[model samples]
Target: MDYKCTLDNADSFLNQLKLHRDRKEKVAVLSDLGGWERAEGMIREIVHKAGADYLVLDNGSALDIAKIVAVNGVFKTDCSC
Candidate 1:
């Protein structure tokens, strides 16, 4: 199943990955770390999907993600191909 993953907020990107994993979906995120917030259970689902090893590239922070959304705004989902 191919699904379009779009984040509506910077910090929520990882959360999105977690959301995806809650349904047992594998994903990879490549983006910034500064935007990552330390919220509880923020990465619980992600950690569970670690078998697939969904990564958040900070380019090194160990705490990062591919955020289509960066704070004051976000990206729209378009799955037309």
Candidate 2:
């Protein structure tokens, strides 16, 4: 289902999503809050640059920040010479 989230609650919502017990319970971001518009835009741009198919958070199953790190190549594997 979809949920309306604000900056105050965004972290909580994503954290709950990560901690969700039911695998079938689908939670998606319903709408972007005015207070978080700029942050959302930045996130959307980053997701877009990461080759996301769409800008909506609902397009994905989770909204955790870890997803961003994965997309932004922060977890790259390196080989030592």
Task: Highest TM-score: give the candidate number.
Answer: 1
lDDT of 1: 0.37
Candidate number of the best lDDT = 1
**Per-residue CA lDDT of candidate 2, range 1-81, in tens?**
933223332222333333332343333333233221211212221122353323333333323242321121112122111
Per-residue error (Å), model 1, residue 48: 14
Question: Between which residue pairs do clashes occur in model 2?
Answer: none
TM-scores, in order shown?
0.30, 0.24
* lDDT assessment of candidate 2: 0.28
Query: Where's the lowest-lDDT run of ten residues in candidate 1?
Result: 71-80
- The models' CA-based lDDT, in order, is 0.37, 0.28
- Kindly provide the TM-score of model 1 when superposed on the true structure, using C-alpha atoms: 0.30
Candidate 1 residues 42-64, lDDT tens each?
23333324443333332322433
